[model samples]
Target chain A: MNWMTTIFYFFGAITVLSALGILFTRNVLHATFLLMLSFFSVAGIYVLGNASFIGVTQLLIYVGGILILMVFGLMLTTKLNGKALVTENHNRLIGVLLGTVFFSILSYIIIFSANFEMLKSNKTLPENAVEFIGINLMSNYLIPFEIAAILLLVALIGAAVISEKRKEKQE
Target chain B: MSTIIFFLPFILIYTIFAVYGERKISAFIQDRYGPMEVGKYGWYQTVADLLKLIQKEDIVPKKASKKLFLIAPVIIFTSIFCGFVVLPITSSWEGTLTQNGVYFLLAIVSLDVVGILMAGWGANSKYSLLGALRSVAQIISYEIPVTLSVLCVIMISQSLNLQEISYQQGILINAFPDMENVKNYLFGISALNIDVTNWGGVFTWNIFRAPVLIPVFIIYFISTLAESNRAPFDLPEAESELVAGFHTEYSGFRWAIIMLSEYGMMLLVALLGVILFLGSWNTPLPNIGNIMLANWTTGEPETIAGNLWSVFWLLSKALMWIAVQMWVRWTYPRLRIDQLMSLSWKYLTPFAMFLIFVSGLWRLLMI
Candidate 1:
């Protein structure tokens, strides 16, 4: 295989393997780190696909910000005792059956979709995707962009309100 | 890959010197000679320390998460090295991976937080954990202002490429033909229009491009100081409070690697400030015909002379900033945690946002 294909497979394998590792890992901290690896590998795939901005954004927001927060939360909540953070499985047979069915359906849809042919063809992105994105956000996609901002503002306010109420209740 | 081969040795040597410089400067500030015994002027002190540190036993506490603890330093050091890959050292000397260089650097830099968190959590020590949490909160809060300040410059430059930003700063701000016309100019009263033909060199730096951006530049520098965990914003790693902070449990080569990475990051931020605000690699004077300063002559980028001068100027500017950082670290008392958070969220953040708005308006109306 060509080098591009090899690199693509390498990223794909890393993404899939680390995601599975997260599911199987007993320790919450180990699982969180595995999740980070999975996210980073996905970012690698995005970079390989010519979505450089999206790739870096994924790395910055997911791996850097959100993952750190997750790990921080885990570390703070856990006790000092070196306990193996394993959870007992309930209804494992049902979970396995449902998971298999879900995978089968996903693969069937992917194989038969009309967009499959188009996905096979490689299309080069614009040289200045960031500039294009900025112009589009300001022009055609202005409404949705503003809506996203408003949504984020609402979330921020909600979080503050909830936390303030908690503090009052504690007092 | 080849860049890494060349860069590794350079960074290794640089970290040694930087460590020595930091120690000597701190000593001088405290009214004492630092590292006087090791070699002439203590230049060999860092070398000796490195040798000693390398031979020391690598100890992992029984309670520590062995895997995470072992990998934390490697990840931290590697992430810093990864950042160097996109740094536009001299345009020609830049690594091949320069696409969206600023964004890439930001991403790589943020990865260090993850490494620090891992180190703190994996060590199974309360001090390390507390330091990690403080670092996380401080870095996250400080990052907002730093990003906004950079965006202010980026808004004006209209490009994410470091090379492009540096190239835009080439135009001189020499409104006056002669240097003697400034006698009557007092209290910021001068009609200095940006002149592309006559290079006013240092005056074309982003900080001086517009009056409002001066605040933005100051805010950026302050935020960088906090981001890199330097004083007076170094509450996270306050030695007296946290006992060496997140790496308290680490020893030997692992601890040395962590220190090296910290110095690397300090240099990284310094270099970014140079590129973004201080006019990267551009000399103070335009190339005067016939009578040139020989080795210090500015050349068109990509030529041999240009390459040499670019490295020279950029390195000098970055080193100057690093010295300032060291000076500030020694001079100021560490801020309290509450004060640090307030400085970031209350003052720096709001002011940065205002500066961004004002700079945008300035660019729109004036430029």
Candidate 2:
């Protein structure tokens, strides 16, 4: 159809393909990279859907932060004995059953409950989504926002304390 | 898309001259001549090196993972190149119309860490793996301070769009009538009785607009230095220790691509620093009484002359900073890993957090 639709389909295809690739790839490192690709494609879809702040944040947190940490952890843990790091799947029957159930539920929601007509109509989103989000967070969602901040602060302190205890034990 | 096309050639040419410039600067610092055999004043030395690298054998290590090894440089170059897409080069010529331009630039740039890791692990070398791990740790740790410092600018400017931030620092405020409140104050002081909306210069820049930002700018510069893996923060690629760090196994054209992206990262951070603190593309000349210097310097945004002036100012300022990066690189010895971590976490991060609070107070009380 339109260029935007074409681009959306392109990103969606990558997301799906990369997800499948991650599942099938034997090399653990390759799977991790494929996961990064899938996350990136999903971020692309978010940007295409006019949620750029969410898209960039997804990139910042997932691709940049978490994925780098994952790669770091993988490298540090994997013994480099002149061999590729490989993974083998376990509980295949249960995995397939769970995956099928989740897929069917998602498909059912899309097919039976979704309003395709409303999606087809050109409903304009906010011009400045960041400003809109910021306003809502400060005004309407202030209590929840502050609570989340406190929760994160607590988690941060907990991490520091845990690490400090380990250091003390080693001492 | 057009900006990408324009920037590809600009980056190539920039890398050429920057490589030569870095050599010459280092040579000057060491009291020795650098690259004397190429073109006039050794201007074509990097060009010759480029030619040589292009013809060299492209090498992939024997035991390396072929796929990731081959793709790592591409990922590294692409992620850094993508950062340029959101950067506003002139008042009228931003690459993309992203509302969250600053945030997008930062997020995309951080993706390079993934590529560096890929390069490191894919290389299958002890040196490469160690280098990549060190790089990832340093970059991840330093990002906190850099983001926090940038948050200070975002708080003061009240916008994340790079172009809007640029416009706020110039005589161009007349174009946005809604920003009258911001324009009325000179250096965030209404009592000055001097409207700096027409005055575009150092006085109107972010460092002066909120003087608390001076220390914030210093923190930003230092953190960015670490982010780009330049010295004295270049422990990731410490030549004495790691023999090129994460890119140790790369060779020929792939190595050239990594080098190009490394220089590109430097330019990108320098340009961002200019935009966030120095003044973006706005002229440094201010309008003194009866002088109209700023008016004479900056042209109308729609005009070709204006675009040229904007490009000239922005590039000159950014290039000056890049030179400073090189100067600092050669001046200071590479920092040890523990010192680097402590400098970032203990010093820069706390200072930046304090400045963010000061910025909040400044925004609340001053403007």
Candidate 3:
């Protein structure tokens, strides 16, 4: 009905399309690329929701940081001479059954969930909302913020330990 | 104006100028005549190059993945356009939705790495894969420092929203020197020496305020160079080993998108430098430009001159930073991968943590 809804639909379409691409693609790398598309579209959805900071962080950290790491790990460990890059499940019936079950559950919740209407409020423009997020992160979430620092340090050390292959003493 | 959109050729023409500028700049720096042959000052060289890329039969290698192979370029081009949304272009030169702008802008940006990774993997070549992997490692490692450094700014300014961050920085005057006098000026009270230069953050654009931030800035800028895939950190496509890096199999508009995304990324990193390191849209002096123009509730200055001036301020700052990046890129030789890792993990990582600690202290003591 409004501009925001229009944007939501557009991004939502892209998200679904990319998700479909992820499901249909055979190549692992191709699937990853589709996942990138899905991630970006979801970030767009975040922008639409007015949580611009979180959306950008999601992109920078997830697509840029984590996914890249996943792809790189795949590259490093992959035996390229192998026949097919894409891997799929042999049993489609069980897979489809599980997929349908999950899909049905989600749909049932969406359709049957009562007492709430999808009435949208023009809560914020994108830029203003981001500013508020910044404020809240500093003033309110300071503890979590400090904790995030410690977590990053732990991650850094953990990654170092895992990746650092101790050289065996040559006989 | 929509009329300007019709002149897409104008953008094309601007490409020629961009090429000439690049040539002329590199030439000047190297003390050579760069491009004098093609249409004087080699202005036509980029057009010539464009024509060449256009004429070259677009090739997709036989072994390459088809779907992702084609889509890679499209994603790059689309992603590059996203940065413009949040960036405040001159004083009054507001571009698009400034709200939720950081996410809209940065999300599209980080996606470029995905494109690079895809370009590498889709090529189905050893060189492509190697380059892609290196790019992945390099981007991820450097990203931590870059994010941490940016966090310092976010913490100091207390905003994740880019536009508001820009607004919050605004030129603050040091009233502490004359606090006794200033207080007098404010509350009709008499002069007290007060013993401070507005000691907290009223002065020094973060740099002057926290001189200790210099190391963090250095670490950040260095890692950011890697994050933007600049030289020294550009090990993924190191020319001697991998030909053209991950883009080896790419051709046609796809290659164009790749290059465009790259330059666009270069521009983004530089602009972010302007925001974080430089005073952003704020002038060095207090109360010189109209801060009110930044607040969107009041429409941007209606006059063309006013809007143009603000746009001037924003662009000038961004360009100055780009120049700095170029200077650094040309001046430094590429770092080896091991060296690069050591710099991030061993040096920058620890150094950034220390900077954060120091920043906290500076805030406690000064604020």
Candidate 4:
């Protein structure tokens, strides 16, 4: 395989491995960090696909922003021992059957997809992709950015109120 | 100039220097010498710290999740390093071997939020978790102002590419012989600009040409401090209360990673200050020849010397901003988490929005 193929395979393997690790990890905190690793390696896939902007965004939003929030949530809400947050499934047989079927379907899709030789080398950052998003965000899609801000604002206030509810309740 | 080639070492050196400088400056300000025993006035203190950290045994507490513990510091280090990929150092220098440099940097900055969170979780420490959560909230909340202020800059510059933005800035518009007589492309011989004090003398720095840059300057600098998780916004890692904050559980090399990453980020943000607000590599005025002939050579940058001079000018400008950050770090006390959030969401965001609106209006009015 060419160097490009090797790198691609490496990132892909890492991504898949991290994802599986997240799924299997019983420890809640461990799982969240694993999830972080999983998300980052997928971002690596985006980088390989020449979507560095999206890749970085994926890293920023998922790995940096979202994962941190999730970990914090896990840590704050859980007991001193982070491993105590485990919820063992009583229906292990059904869970295993369902997991196996899902894995089978996923593997079948991946195997078929691999046969297509979909990889094509394009070195230069495709112009209209990265700059165009920023342009569209400012010009055409300005309303969306504004709207997203508003949604975030509402969520912030809601989260704040919920956290502060105990103070009101006690008073 | 060769994109990644110029700034890769700079990122490493800046990170190393920031830690070294923070200690040295802090000690100096506090009336004591700091870490001088390590290496030449503590020049290699951070390096010694790194060696010590690496040699020290790794600790995974019995309560900690082993896998996540292994993963957390790597997460922190990897994500912060990503930011260097997009930094435009000089007018020519880009850290990444690509365009869409701004996007890359923005993405990388965003990733630090995750690192803090992961560190908290993986350690399974209460204080670490608290620090992590607070950080995530603080960073997310502050992101609004940061984005809005950057938006103001992007709107003014009309490009997202860091190199292009700096290159356009590097132009010595006032250096042109008939610069004063030159008509605006959008506006006619319009109302002669109010503040042309520097026009006759200082030549074409960004401040004079883009008046919006001044408020954008204030808003941008404040937002940069918040973005870098520097004091007063450093509530998440309040040294007094949080017990070393989010990376509290980290010892040895893990702790080193966190410290180095923080400094690297400080330098990155400072570099952004120089590139965005200050006339990056471009001298405040271009026509030093005129100044030299008139025996006023002090005002003009030393472009007559060589490329080395321009590099010096660029580094000097960047260092000035870094010093400002250092000063701010020393001067301010940490804010409360609530205070930090309110400052970003309530105050800074609205101000940035208003500034952007006014700037856009002002630009249109000029036309």
Tens digit per residue, CA lDDT, model 2, B10-53 = 99999988999998888778755446645687767677788899
DockQ of 1: 0.69
Q: In model 3 chain A, which range of ten residues has the least summed lDDT? A: A114-123
Regarding DockQ, does 2 or 3 come out ahead? 2
Q: How many backbone clashes does candidate 1 have?
A: 1
- Evaluate candidate 2 and give its CAPRI docking class based on DockQ: high
Residue-wise C-alpha lDDT for candidate 2, range A1-171, written one tens digit per residue: 999999999999999999999989998888998999899999999988888899999999898888888888887877556566888889999999999999999999999989877468967678888889999999999999999999999988998888874435553
Better of 1 and 3 by TM-score: 1
Ranking by DockQ: 2, 1, 3, 4
Alpha carbon lDDT at A75, candidate 1: 77
Measured over all alpha carbons after superposition, the RMSD of each candidate to the real structure, in angstroms, is 4.8, 2.1, 6.5, 5.7
Ranking by lDDT: 2, 1, 4, 3
In candidate 2, which residue ranges exceed 4 Å CA deviation? A80-83, A116-121, A165-171, B36-39
Report per-candidate TM-score of chain A alone.
Answer: 0.87, 0.87, 0.75, 0.73
List residue ranges in candidate 4 displaced over 4 A.
A80-82, A87-126, A134-171, B1-8, B15-20, B33-62, B90-93, B172-206, B288-307, B365-367
Choose the strongest candidate by lDDT.
Answer: 2
For model 4 the local lDDT of residue B190 reads 33
Worst 10 residues of 1 chain B by lDDT: B179-188
Best prediction by TM-score: 2
Q: Comparing to the true complex, what docking class would candidate 4 get?
A: acceptable
Steric clash pairs (candidate 3): A126-B99, A126-B100, A127-B99, A127-B100, B90-B310, B90-B311, B91-B310, B91-B311, B180-B192
**Cα lDDT for residue A71, candidate 1:** 82
Q: Taking the tens digit of each residue's C-alpha lDDT, what string does model 3 give over A1-171?
A: 998999999999999998988888787766776787788789789756766566777787778777877776665555456444677767899988999999999989987885344344534544356556667889999999989999999998999999998999999
Name the better of 2 and 3 by TM-score.
2
